[model samples]
Target: MSRRTLVAGIGNVFLGDDGFGVETVRRLSAPGAAAARLPDGVETADIGVRGVHLAYQLLDGYDTLVLVDATARGGAPGTLYLIEAGADGPVAPQTPVLDGHQMSPDAVLALLDTLCAGTGAAPPRRIWVVGCEPGSLDEGIGLSPPVAAAVDEAVRMVLDLVHHQDEETPQDEPGVAAN
Candidate 1:
């Protein structure tokens, strides 16, 4: 398979559940890292609180991209959402914070779109986001109970998507998927 899958966790570790993304990455990076079971081609990285930095990461050769973050939209805490990258969607503005570190996921997508347009190349074939609802984004450094519990589930969902994608695409030979 191709090493063209990038899973990024985005969040601020200083805030409570807002740190969900970073924490999830940590959990998956531990010795028994649960996310390690994901399909062999995909690579995961923690992009904690980096705004435009995500765009740079996207510059790497990746056919698919998945971003995990904590979203607050008045939903029940710990709710998980599978969001596609686009303009017309239910995901709200990325204005949750006022600091310079704040950057919209859409903006990153736009940057990729512009780059692809300029170069006459296709953008990431797949871009998905797993958003976890946060009960509190107050000044703190950990995830609440519910959000923490959903970490494993989120990892599983992403891996499942990766596997399904692999099965859908025809490989050159058996056990050989795009890399």
Candidate 2:
């Protein structure tokens, strides 16, 4: 099977702003939603702290992967970061700005890699992470105003990238495929 696209949101619902990713998915999955207009073959999921279960969704085969999460690295609130996985940097697990989830994003990715290796499957060709800096990650329940606003921007960024890729990729010619 060719690679499909997967958008996995990871976070903690109990923690304020930590639920940004899951909340985004929930918003996307609404009835008669605009998210339905997303490209065909693109699937989205809310995998809050359940990174181990990611293998099942990811196993199907996906070329592009987008992960949305709330992060804090001393940046301004609602800061958006588009980071490529396995880029030139140390893949260290950072301490959570707010203690709610059991595993960090990098740890989840590592677990996914281990699962893929054990099953002899290839990982996605591209992995983009969209991070929103949080104003609060406390033991509260809702997203801060700034972080909430960032979700719209994050969705737009992901959608634009997907459409761009769809346009750039060539279709099959006769019996030859670009892949």
Candidate 3:
């Protein structure tokens, strides 16, 4: 497959704002979604709470991988952060805990590192985390008000990355993609 970019969304929908990634990707994949017009080779998936599954999917080669998730960084809820991580990964400092049931981006990256070692599948050249500050990770079905509102912006951010990455370094405010 000529998958150039993979925008994977992973999170626990049962936990309120923690579902941001899942929701954002849902919007991005909608039939008429703004990001739907992306050129061929960009792929998106809603990998809800499946850390191990994401690790295995890396077997397919992609030059860039953009992960969308809810990050609790002690910032205000709904805040957006675009962090570009090295090949070793963004959460390399912390020890990754491998759990099929639960895995943070850190854990996922660590698992991928190990997989690449044994399988010889090269990891993506660039990795990015488009994260949103979560309000409540508490057990719940719906997102908090603030988090729900930020979904649109998060979608735009992902669109920006896949659209402009090859053209130039992504800007803080990415330009609108031409039709």
Report lDDT per candidate.
0.69, 0.71, 0.81
Model 1 over residues 109-167: C-alpha lDDT tens digits? 66666666776666677777777889888998878898888887766666666666545
Task: Single out the weakest 10-residue window by summed lDDT for candidate 1.
Answer: 170-179
Order of the predicted models by lDDT, top scorer first: 3, 2, 1
Highest TM-score model number: 3
Q: What TM-score number comes out for model 2?
A: 0.81
The residue ranges of model 3 lying beyond 4 angstroms of the native Cα positions read 1-3, 87-96, 174-179
lDDT tens per residue, model 3, 1-179 = 56499899989999998899999999998888566666678888999988888888977878888898888777788887787766342456253466578677778877888898899999887888888889999998989998898889888888888988775467675422211
Tens digits of lDDT, candidate 2, 35-151: 876778778888887765665567767888878788666677887766667766535556432333466777666665766788987777777676778899899889999899877
Of candidates 2 and 1, the better by TM-score: 2
lDDT of 2 at 134: 85
Each prediction's TM-score against the native? 0.78, 0.81, 0.88
Global lDDT of model 3: 0.81
C-alpha lDDT of residue 122 in model 2: 74
What root-mean-square deviation over C-alphas does model 1 reach? 7.1
C-alpha displacement of 45 in model 2, angstroms? 0.4
